[model samples]
Target chain A: MKNILIASTSTIHGSSYLEYILDDLATFFKDTEEILFIPYARPGGIFYDDYTKTAQKAFSKINVRVKGIHTFENPIEAIRNAKGIFTGGGNTFILINMLYKNNLVEVLREVVNNGTHYLGTSAGSNICGLTIRTTNDMPIIYPPSFDALKLVPFNINPHYLDPDINSKHMGETRETRIKEFHNFNTQPVIGLREGSWLHVKNDSILLKGKLSARVFEVEKAPYEVESGTELNGLK
Target chain B: MKNILIASTSTIHGSSYLEYILDDLATFFKDTEEILFIPYARPGGIFYDDYTKTAQKAFSKINVRVKGIHTFENPIEAIRNAKGIFTGGGNTFILINMLYKNNLVEVLREVVNNGTHYLGTSAGSNICGLTIRTTNDMPIIYPPSFDALKLVPFNINPHYLDPDINSKHMGETRETRIKEFHNFNTQPVIGLREGSWLHVKNDSILLKGKLSARVFEVEKAPYEVESGTELNGLK
Candidate 1:
């Protein structure tokens, strides 16, 4: 009963914004006329209007009109009547904080569960989990809670990178960080590399994009799930 | 008078834990025979006693004995009576969370400001900031607040690294994340590179080690400060 596109990143190396996934996006939103964009994440201090315009330009190629939820007088109502929704990438802390601040958290979830199409990239994708405990973004701001939409049973670690063997930096690797997260949390986590995503429809959650996503569970050796694998049973 | 050695990391590449800064630590802690180790930020799933033992091994080289606070019957009294204190690194959230959980945040700060000769590495150094907002660690656990010891006016982004120009990873770099942090917070932040530290004696905060540190202030271009530069003026 759900139509969601949870992408690891909106942009990748040597590619334009959403260019790599344009075809997939077109098919994902084919049934919709317009989609509401949540530009609260606003990567790199991008203004909300400017961010929305970028999204609009990208969606224009798909013949789907786009509008930022901020433009609405009643955003709750906008979510209620939206044909589809797209939450773009930025800072996860700021994005989730804004979601809770605007009181859009529950309403958006409710509408999406009722069959409103959804799209999330990067920070947006991270919010489609039970909690934001596995996010790779800095805690630039504190949200009211770490709890997320719970759209998926497990958490998402977007823009996931493998440990650089030659680098001498002492910072914890991406895998180590998620493993440390398992020390305090039990939820499964999917480390979604740049071009990967999860396409959830009803009870089926299919891995999209070309890269295999690293899946981590408590007290278990992490393994990779290929592009065509079903990730719905991860929990 | 304050005596503090706030290092960017406890371990560096190809070196034993605390090896890179042992001499500096010996000088910093020369006045004391024993140090109460705040092993709450146990990195890498190391148990409290085991972490204490590791700290003991490092400090033993300087003829100093280390004991974990968890072994104390009254941690508050231990903090008050201890001749010196060392808070090792692990995860900032867990370290700060346990500090708050044990009601030791204010007491530890009080004792340190009262000439407790405090030393902090990595996550420990992060907590000496105005808030734990600038730490590079993953938020595996939620603390009661991001508010930290405020031992200094500015925040510390320990284990700070420059953006990898060659990497195609789409994740936000360390500098970008801090800029985003400035969008919501006003405090100054010092990006302490590995092998770098801030040696505080009373009011003078001197940057120590082999490398320059990055200084970040709101709306200002982040610039490098040489190893010997005084960081007390950041605020």
Candidate 2:
């Protein structure tokens, strides 16, 4: 059986890194001893070792050891051998670019499908969908392709923010950017708000956080789905 | 002589499309009677003809007629023979993909180098830089390359918004995004606030409008450059 947790963000307001979701993670990784951490996203350009240490400290509470994928001689072998895998948030382009460079995209997919528990946050979570086109991150680097794991039927727009009516800024809101994506692509998109996540077990995917997620389909109105809602078969 | 106006956005918060810059445009386009409009970045998925009509309505106020480049049977030929050019904003990836698809990148650069007056807003303005890596728009479609016209020395982040102090969102801010870009790319970036623009003529590139732009260089602290500051030789 496949078990995964795809979170919108690693940290929320008034919370330390991964602090809010630590308890949930303890239960999620109860059977696992250690996890291989993919730190290629490097949020704010953090070094891989330092980022891994942060993960190690967080997962310590759950009695799970964390190791950086860069420490291994072969990343593909590492993923296959990992009891659990965690890809933390940063820049999606950088993460996807490194994934393609190391030829780990397929091996990681195969391992996850064969039942290695998986956890993804932010940029990490965005790759669990059909494409990274809906990501809010700036395209700092170009990957070989926009195609992703297709773990879900649609795309995930992580850190999805709602429009602030009182703001003076003129930039396109999150909804506007997604609608523009629908113009050229037919993939449905889920605006996964902060503190929200998708819990995938076997063939079922459920919204597992407190906040409601925004759902968007082509030529239709964008609506909200409450927590605990099933999100499989969105396409 | 490379006469160009690279604006951050088409519309500001209170203005109706192009109202704030009308007087300046009247002077900037004084020598041209007709201008070719590139509507490939169709904001909100608007049709080419309709987007062209919007440009037509705006330019009519300055006594300059607008024509959509799509209407021309030969795009390269139309670019070569144009009196002036205006590339409206929408999605940067869409604009660049279509530009590469039609093989107009070099031709547009050649004509602009030969002194064709050009105006670009948002996505259009983004292409004037070293690359589109700093663009705020979503990557709805993949382009052949992130490379752009290189009309300017650095990248331009249009619709550049400042960090909100009280917001609850956990996504990367514009500055955070640009800092991440600096980690992988060496090119400097200018965050052009809405209603601000860069006026390039011959060898001089000057920031114009009421607001200051944020400048970021690798390994250096980002600083604010006031309006009227020359931006050439920034790399």
How much native contact recovery, as a fraction, does model 2 achieve? 0.89
Candidate 1 clash pair list: none
Report the lDDT tens digits of candidate 2 across residue range B72-146. Answer: 999999999999999999899999999999999999989998999999999999999989999999999999999
Off by over 4 Å in 2: A43-46, B43-46
Candidate whose lDDT is highest = 2
Tell me the RMSD of model 1 versus the true structure: 1.4
Interface RMSD, in order shown: 1.6, 1.5
lDDT of 2 at A35: 90
Q: Per-residue alpha-carbon lDDT of model 1 for A1-235, expressed as tens digits?
A: 9988899999999988899999998998888999998998974344998999889988898899999898899999999999999999988889999889989999988998888999999999999998888888778777889899999999999999999999899889999999889988999999999999899999999998989999999999999999999977789
Pairs that collide in candidate 2 are: none
TM (chain A), candidate 1: 0.97
For every candidate, the chain B TM-score is 0.97, 0.98
Residue A183 local lDDT, model 2:
87
